[model samples]
Structures are given as C-alpha cells and as structure tokens.
Target: CLTGAPGDAARNAAFLVDHSDCPAVSLAGDLSLAGLAWMFSRAAGVVSVNTGTMHLAALAGAPTVGLHGPTNPLRWGPWGRNVQSLLPHSGACAYLNLGFEYPDPPVTCLENLPVSDVLDALERMGLRERAFAGD
Candidate 1:
C-alpha cells in the first residue's frame, strides 16, 4: 500500500508503482486522520519522511522508518520502539530547529540519502523478509 498526503506522496506513489514488481495502491489524500491511523495499525511497516504520517505510524504500532535530511532526527524523528531514523552520512543538512531557526545552509535534500541505507534500516527493523540481495 502507498499511503500519505497529497503532492509528493501522490507523485511518489505513482513513480513507485510504475517501477514496482507487484501491485500497489495509493491512499494519498483519500484518507482521514483516523483512517490513516487504522491503516497504519495494519501495515507491516511504513517508510515516511519527517511528517505527521511518520508520527502517526509510530503511534499506531507500525514499524516505521523516518527519513531525515534538512531536519534533525533528535528533534523531529518518529518516536517509539519500532522505529528507525535515516539521515545523511555527512550530517550537514540537519539544521532546522523550532521550525524557524537554522544555523547552516542546506547542503542537500533527502535525495542524497542512499537507498541502501533505507534497505538496511528496514532489515534492522525486521520489516523486510530478509536483507536485500546483492547485485
């Protein structure tokens, strides 16, 4: 299932489904907050950027992976036992604080984060059946 808010969520779902091996469905912009929470409770795992969706997923007891780039994980990351937060390796982009103050210029966006890191995080979180196969 591909679920999130509109805009990037819809585009992301489309892009993923276009390249996916199996079937995929998107609930972006189609679900209420309660609906989202219920859906999250049933999901095997959820990977979300720093958004309310991430917090909701964690609150709903889903294994969640929160991706952080220009935001500090310490301040805005998902909270729970079944959660993991992914950040850039250089640690240069996490500057946002109090939703206003930023001490450094943005060095990169989430695009710079490696997919391998995400996969590894899922594996560590036991969300995936197994580690990603070597290519």
Candidate 2:
C-alpha cells in the first residue's frame, strides 16, 4: 500500500502499480493515521520513502526498508528493529534535508539510488524470502 494526497505523484504511482505485474495496491488519503497503524501492524514488511509511514511501519514492528534521499539516514531513518536504510552513494543533494539552511529541498537525492538497489536491500534483509515463504 502507499500514501499520499490526490496529486501528480499519487496518480503516477497508481499508474505504475496498475501497469506492473507486482501484487500491490495503492492507498492514498482514504486512511487515517490510526488506520495506517493498524495496517502496518498487519504488514509483513513495508517499503517507503522518507515519509511518516516508514517510521510508523517500523514502530509497528514490520520489517521496513526506508529510502533516504535529502535527509541523512543517521539522523532521520526509521527507528525500530528489523529496519534497513538505502541512500544515494554520493551526491551534492544526498544530505540536503529541508530546513532553513535548505528552505526548498531539491527533488530527492535518494532517487539516485535505483529501484534495483531497493530490491537488493530487501533481498539482503531477507524480506523477499519471508514474503515468498508467506511468513
């Protein structure tokens, strides 16, 4: 599942999920925070960008993979056990968190890390194994 308001990003993500063969669904603003927490509690694992859901999922005790871009994982990664972080190797935008120093953050430097990197991280964390094993 996914989270976002009805916007370009949400529409685009829905488009991708609809076209892809992955057994996935996108949930936008249809859920409240409590609902999200409940969903996370039921999830075997979760993949999220630098967003609240990532942290929530981790707190819910789900194995979580967090995609960090502008923010440094050391300072902002999800807090919990069974959590893994992925970030861009090196880039000017890598640690540029949005704040007074960087009032307007650029598009995610984390985007430099490709989808393959996420898949690989999940593989290394054995999320894929647990998922396919139906654990």
Candidate 3:
C-alpha cells in the first residue's frame, strides 16, 4: 500500500493484520533507496504507481503491476514484459501528459477501475492462481 508519511500506515496495517487471516507486511513512511532495494529483493511481485519505487522494482527484475490514472501508461509505465499497467478510460483526466502529482489525483481514476477489472488483469498476468494443489 502506498501511504504518505503521517504514520497512520502502521495503525492501518495493524488493523488489517488483526482483522484478516492472511499475513500482512507493512513498511511505513517514506522509504529510502536501500529500503526499496530490500523490499524488491524479497518480494514475489510489485504493485505500485508510476513512481520511482516502481522503476526500482522493474530494474530489480521483479514483475510490476502499475496503477495509472492521469498519466499515460505508454509513456510512463515500466518497460518490461513482466510489467502490467492499468489505466482509466480515455479523458479521465486532462493532465495525462504530465507526471504524477496532486493536481491529477490517481485516486479518482483508480476508484473507477472495478475490483474485477483489477483481478482480471492480475489473472492475465498470471499473478492470480489457486493457492495449492488442493484447497
């Protein structure tokens, strides 16, 4: 989860962990290059916005699923076979040419993307599958 540095991420993560049965890992606050490197080293896949961290994960050879909104995925999304990008409908925002910023909040476009759409994208990317041989 991409969380800005107010420290609420820890509280939110704790709540998620407590409420869910699946294991959850939280990395709160702004992460340094080394921190990002460490995360990429251990991750099975990366899910992030079109940001520097996403770029780092791409460079680290991790499969990255990028969430794009106002930004055009063709120009800004990660460049690799393992990269899968999802963009909102055309004309979703006028600032598509510009990089990510508060002016073109991705939240609106992101919210417009249905959960099923995201799951389908993940499934197409081969990131979603049955947990084991028998479940």
Name the candidate that leads on TM-score: 1
lDDT of 2: 0.76
lDDT preference between candidates 1 and 3, better one: 1
TM-score of each: 0.81, 0.78, 0.70
In candidate 2, how many Å is residue 15 off?
A: 1.9
lDDT tens digits by residue: candidate 2, 29-56: 6777898898898887899886888899
Q: Which stretches of candidate 3 lie over 4 Å from their true place?
A: 1-8, 14-19, 29-31, 89-91, 100-107, 130-135
Sorted on lDDT, best first, the list reads 1, 2, 3
TM-score, cand. 1: 0.81
Whichever of 1 and 2 has more lDDT, that candidate is 1
The weakest ten consecutive residues by lDDT in model 2 span 94-103
How accurate locally is residue 31 in candidate 1, as Cα lDDT from 0 to 100? Answer: 87
Q: What's the TM for model 2?
A: 0.78
Error of 3 at 46 (Å): 1.3
The sequence of per-residue lDDT tens digits that candidate 3 reaches over residues 1-135 is: 443344758786777778786445455576767777777766667777778777788777777778786667787888765888887654464255655454623445666655666666667777666322243
Clashing pairs in 2: 69-110
lDDT of each: 0.82, 0.76, 0.66
| 1-135: candidate 1 lDDT, tens digit per residue | 677677658696767767886456777788889999999998888898898989999999999999998788999999987999998776467777677655555356687789889888898887666433442
